[model samples]
Target: MNIDDMESLDEETRKEIEELRRITPEKHGNAFFAQAQFNLGATFIKNGNIEEALEAFSNIQHLHSPKLYAAAQYHIGEIIESNGDIESALSIWRNINHSDNPEIYAAAQSYIGFVLFEKNDIEEALLVWGNITHADAPEQYVQAQFNIGICLSEKLNKEEALLAWSNITRLDDPELYAQAQYNIGSNLLERKHVEGALLSWHNIEKKDNSEAYAKAQLRIGNTLTEQGDYQGGLLAWCNVERLDDLEAYAKAQFKIASFLISFEYKQAAIKELQLIELMDDAEAYAKAQFNIGILLGKNSDIKGAVKAFRNIKYEYDSSAYGNAQYRIARILISNNDLTDYTSAKTCFELAREVFSYEARSYIRILELLEVPETKSFGLSLLDLLNIVLDIVDILTLNFSKYADEEKPFERKLAHYTSTYTSNLLLGNDKNNTRPSSFRLNTINNVNDPSEGQLLIRKLKDVKDNSFVPLAFDKKFHAFISCFTFNHDSLNQFRLYGKQDNKEASGMSLVFKKDFFQSKNLIGGISYLSIDNTLKITEAISNINVKESHDIQGQKIKNENDDQELVRRSVMRCVYLDPTSDYFHLAQRNRLTFFREFGDNIVIKNGTKQSQAEYEWGVYQEYIKIITEKFEVAYQILKTTYKEVETEINNVRFTLGSLKQKELAILVDEILLPLKYLIKHSAFREEQECRMIYITSIDRPEVTMEYGSFLYVEYEPSVKDHLDKIYIAPAALQHKRYFDNILKNVDVPVEVSGNVFR
Candidate 1:
């Protein structure tokens, strides 16, 4: 039968072997009989008939040939060992009478050492192999020498181990030569002679496709890589020619891919990694998949990269598996079209949990972590409002001092009545009433006199129709209020108030010549000095806030005897109550009050007439406030304040300037009730964005449409990466409206001292 046909037909091959065995001459010391019997034993073992093979080898004692019997004993030992009977096989090999056959005796001795080495008796194994004299059996002698070196290396006797391996001069068999050279290289590496090791590894000629040759080639690449010659190492790994060891071949390919990736040959590296699946090594294949993902990602094939990483399977705490998960997250993030930010969030979370802190993925994930913003570039509308509200709170707290010290509207009305009655009874002017109301106006110049004139005209109309007290005149109020803090309040105020209440009654207006330059009023007292008194009042108010627990306390504290009564009196006059008639009067006359002063006070050096020469000075201090400062604040109210209001209820604000629609938007959609928000949220820029994060959820919209759910927007953007993009001030429409309203607006001031009532 043909060899191929015989290999496929095992029964026929066994029958032929049995026939040969039966027909062999039974004469003792007959070479043909011994050869036929040995062949039969080998065929039986090949057929997996270990019992028959063992019986055949044991019958070799009748051959009457020491060499054949010894060989047969060695075969019996191999069969027994193959059957996992290690001790029995060891005993059989040890008892083999190979004294007359040097080759067989040497092989038997080497087998004893091999079994001992496997059993972890390294010292005895070394002694057994070392006892073999290399006088005959070159094959066995070479093997014994190699084994001795391995044992010595295991014993850590580097010098003696190298000497033992180097003793092999004959190199007829390529496997033996490669094995010896490979051992020498290992010992050299152990001794730290990397270059010598490389040289020894390079000389391991693979004349046959042996495992040793494959290992030597792999080691050469490893040594070169250790020496920082990655390019050369990769080339050596690529040159690995081995069919006997698939694992080693896969490892070599993986190394080559890694090296190519280091050099940025991503496409080539990906191809090399892709070939690892052919090796069928689960661990190597997983590692290769991870590396291929990295390569594909580096090449900008994001989808391909994600697929590659997702393919890695569970393996014993596999670093590659963890790494693959991490890469998948990176691929998703880098895609940057996060239609659904939460979709990839789990991937990121899983990657972080799977990888250890020391893993490259873990470190990268940390670097990508979004830290909550403490500050921002531009304030959102709501954020700006919060700041304005905070400023208002501070100002209100300061104004509260006047509220406590000054007479209330009812008391002031009685005092004026008594004075009027006394004067009338004493035959004084019957129509005369002590200054019933007082005006505290902040004078600022307009850019165009016509603009100021326009404002004055508009103010008359507003004053006539409006009923709400204490018109804010955000433009002028911000300008003058800023000075109280030693800060330009105009630039800080973005709020606008508009009120209409017919029942509101009290109104007062007073004007004096040269108020801006002289800083002195009709009473020959310096307004500057009076302004100082107001500043002191504001300072005292701020100090009171810090010292007191409640800003708006129900019970008022009595003034100290040593306190400056005059300063308190003056500050009380400056207090424009939001609900009082005086406040209404001021709002009505606000535009006219502002027009009284020019935008700049031009003081020429040669001018000696101080009063007439000095005009309005440029109000650069508060110019920023009116132009666009409050735009963001307005937008905050306009956009999301209503939605915020429903979730919170601690603090409530009464905004004056907003229209009915704007007010509805605030209550219905934008503003949050203060209960759920931080107390000083308005003062904090971060709170603006934080609110968006809280309320602006991108829930996937589903509707009954055919079978699939329909979404209005696919893949909403992530909030973290988008913070900078949302940074914007109030809307342009609001600013334009304010500009138009302020340009021609005028406030009316009344200089009347008597009350008709």
Candidate 2:
């Protein structure tokens, strides 16, 4: 009967249980009764009532059914194990092994082995497992073999354990075969037989269609990396061709990239990283990009590197974001290009808000870049003003809107006024240059608006003596002008203001004092500022004069005259022009000024009578002065310029520094077309000559040093100027200039004729 129609008896469920037991023997026979008791015991075991389950299982011994009795015994072992009775559990499991049913026998054997393993009787566990060697044994028997392998491996008997696991591959079950192969590889790995382990793991892929193969591939790759075979490891990882498992694939790719970097194959690492298919995972992609940036930065590609680093979001991972921000700022500092200074400053400020580790260094970088310290200081002032303004604006707006409800407004005003007074009192530092504390007090609502406004007005009226003049000196002007003109000519100069607005733009030049002293040079342009009138102004007033004037005393006249020339060198000088195009005018003026003082002009020896000997000496001397005046500054600038050029050249270097196989790939894929294009151009003949020179240099072993190991004798048809010259060891002598030519020329050349062909 349904429960609703059940008898009105107070113990309905109890009566039902008794009725079920009464009919069970007749309805299901003795075997069914035993099975029913076992099932009820299993329910108790599932419900965590182990004692009740054991009591129910004990009743099966009274039943006359062999299969049911075996099941009950097996369940009793499980219940005893759950209750932490190891000896009793083992006894119950061993009893099941004597049962006549094959399935029950296999199950019992597995449980007995597990019990022995837990008891630390590994040998006995293996002995129990070894009894299940029949070919027709259930999959549980194969699983037992795998377990024995694990125990043997733990005992350090890896080889024999691997053999035991290998026998599992003969099982027809695909899952069992995969597990066995994996176990064998694991054992081999413990013994440091990396290749053997990899081979066994690879067999899993061949035998299994499950994720077991993917896991095996990852293990094999890790093993190869541990053994220092990075390339092999990467190749093994690439064997996981499962595009559906993009996360795993991306992880493998990242590992490969990290491995390549460790081996100093950065370009290869970047290439491998780019091949990862999962670009959607922002964290992984950002990490990969960040690593690429670091690699580029280490290799001196600062700008590209900074861009990569700066692309990471602040929200990704705070630590990683902070690190990327720090790197970006550092690269900006090293850039020497002031174009990014403002942005760098902003980035640093943002970084300060989230992380302070890089804040001070960023501040120092800004200081070096000459960003007005007042800019940051101004922010404090503005913050103070904003706070007062916000309070006043809110109070006024709310009061006007809700005059009828004046209580809340009046209370807010009282609170704001109190805060303002407290801040103002604390901010009262009369002697400091920056009213920073005062400003912070206002922003923190520690000062009244009127007092803060008065203080700000006084600060503004104080001449902002905060705006320090650029340190203009005679040497500074000369260096600045020269640096501006030369760097601009090289297409490397970037001014501070509008590109076409020359008057708004300012130029800076730096020098090192040690360089000047070493080179015996003086005078360089340091800084140049153009006013609205377009007049070029110098930062320094006094020009340096040479201590010794002996060199200044002597001079030579034009070619046809032997007259002693008058020395017209000026110790200090300034050239100024008010023209709109002052840079062009300044250039012309400088040319005239040096012409008037011929001794100051650099001279180079050439066919032209006006050509001077060693003009580089004068240029080097000019560079020396600037180097001296601003040693650290100029060095930083020089390094940055060099870095930029290096970055541009790095792409070429990547292909250029290739090994044999890599070089072959590049030549076949890239160089051949380049050669073909050059062959069809006007440079063909020149290219042919260059190609010959390159070929000759390429085989360096065949070309000995011209002077040290080999000698050349030349008898010119018109060398009458050299026929009688003595080859003196201590005086003027006629010596071949081959070494000099080689030292000066960038590209290799041969003297086919009087001309360098």
Candidate 3:
């Protein structure tokens, strides 16, 4: 039978081998015996019996086919390499001298250069590829030239790189040629030849069907964006969406979303980011979720931010996964109103999987891990992680490259109230009306009728006035206390005494600004900043967040202070200006609060990290063996006139990333209560920063006032908090009375008698 017919039947090849053995050497001769042995080896290889295959290949005598004898050695090298013994593999390839099989000789050289290049021995790799020519192994020769181009580029020989890359033809290797075009375009772009770069990148898609085509489009979009042609850039990016390359598609989408954000279309940007969710790429999805979380956090939508971060899968990208973990932990710790140490500890532990902290962090963790089991012998450093993991944090790891210590500066805030209220505040022996401490009133009951009920009014208009009953019908109002961050503004004295035209000249109660931050109430202060006072909310806005991400821990001890942190989510600085773009978003958020987020909280399964690809397990060894069998078979047949092909479809495997989605569930639940922070733009002039505490209506902390309005007694850290008292400018006559009232106070007393006027 013909070898072509025999090639398809391994069983026939085995039968032929047995028949050849039965016949004498003189009957069929060395030709038929050698052919049968070679066919048996290929059969053994296909069956994944490497030992038997190697034995059969060894039976091929050099007297019959020297190329086949040489090809067998090449097969052994592949086996060695697949087993991770690259040294032996390289040695075997180096000795494969076969002038009879020029294709195999050049193909082996191609692999040798590839291994060298991957190991970063660029010069030697280039030297090996330089020996290849178009006459020998035509396809391998083109691939060799591709590697030479990379080598030349790495050595800064831009001119030589272009010349080497120019040698690749679209017909010979379109993928490599497309890559060359990308490199050439990049080089031209760097040289300021904008037209040349565009022309070069434009031809990539004409001949390329691989990821290189999408990459070229991505580059084109970047170039257009850089040249100030935003519409052209956006159009180019939009074209990359359906290019069958998820990573490049993700890059383009991110740019488009960034453009939307820069143009003050944040909601549109959010919708664009959400588009990444429909793609099948895990890394791209993780990246999109991370950015959305950050944007949400910046917008003071803490719930949405947490949900976005939790959506990242650990299996996608280690850095992104680590960042997601660290960010979640930071959010939990910063949101200390709930005092969720247990949850924070779990998040910190997950973050530890990807982040490697400095010596100081390990030392800090070690210091805290002082249990007897953890305090063992000299091998403590190795076992330290095992112990420290039980109690996570002090991992003040920010969004930056490394965790850093915080820097703090002290300051004070002045709260002006009626002299009678101040007298009652200081717990002086007043009438029966004096509370145990200062009172934070419910929003509806606040004196400012126009500004105080702004949030409730806005909510009543959204979803066709739907959320009002769900939020307010149950009397679930947020209690509030307003504070202005002015150090010593003259207008404060003028503004406070005449609230609603009430002639109530009050003394300013100066308290240490750290009092609120210490309690982690997050009062209009960025959760990112745990230490800084309210001096530069406007200035800090200009400073790069990475540079100013220093926070010192000053946790409030319950027994050490009478004040307690109630149910608070976030404290955003009052956004000023009615015409500002952010004000529009804030306004929209209030109106659509009920519509975007339904009456009940939602926990999405989609928010958890995506699963990871599984290891090539059962067929790991077989995959290597069978793949090498084909390599050897190709080499032995390269010099022959006949051609044969073999193929085996690969199976895919996966393992999913796992973590708690409590953070995602909390996002919808928290947004409703935190909605009270935004107010009507009319209150822009007051520049008031209010703290919103969403407590249940039945809590005993609610104190009834005037037999109708409700107030909560919040004993803020007031003992050392009173910095100084300034009697209102109009109340100069009562300055002596204020002094007598604050006689026990060690702070300075001043008269604000028409100082500005």
- Deviation (Å) of 602 in candidate 1: 71
Name the TM-score of candidate 2.
Answer: 0.36
Local error of candidate 3 at 441, Å? 53
Per-residue accuracy of model 2 over 625-659 as CA lDDT, tens digit each: 43344334323323433333343244344434433
Query: Order the candidates by lDDT, highest first — what do you get?
Result: 3, 1, 2
- The segments of candidate 3 whose C-alpha lies over 4 angstroms from its true place after superposition are 1-11, 19-37, 49-52, 55-73, 79-92, 115-121, 187-194, 278-757
C-alpha RMSD in Å of predicted model 3 compared with the true structure? 30.2
Considering summed lDDT, which 10 consecutive residues are worst modelled in model 1? 540-549
Q: How close is candidate 3 to the true structure, as a TM-score?
A: 0.40
TM-scores, all models, native as reference: 0.40, 0.36, 0.40
Q: Candidate 2: lDDT over CA atoms?
A: 0.42
Candidate of highest lDDT: 3
Error (Å) of candidate 2 at residue 589 is: 62
Q: Against the true structure, candidate 1 has what lDDT?
A: 0.43
Q: Measured by C-alpha RMSD in angstroms, how accurate is candidate 2?
A: 33.3
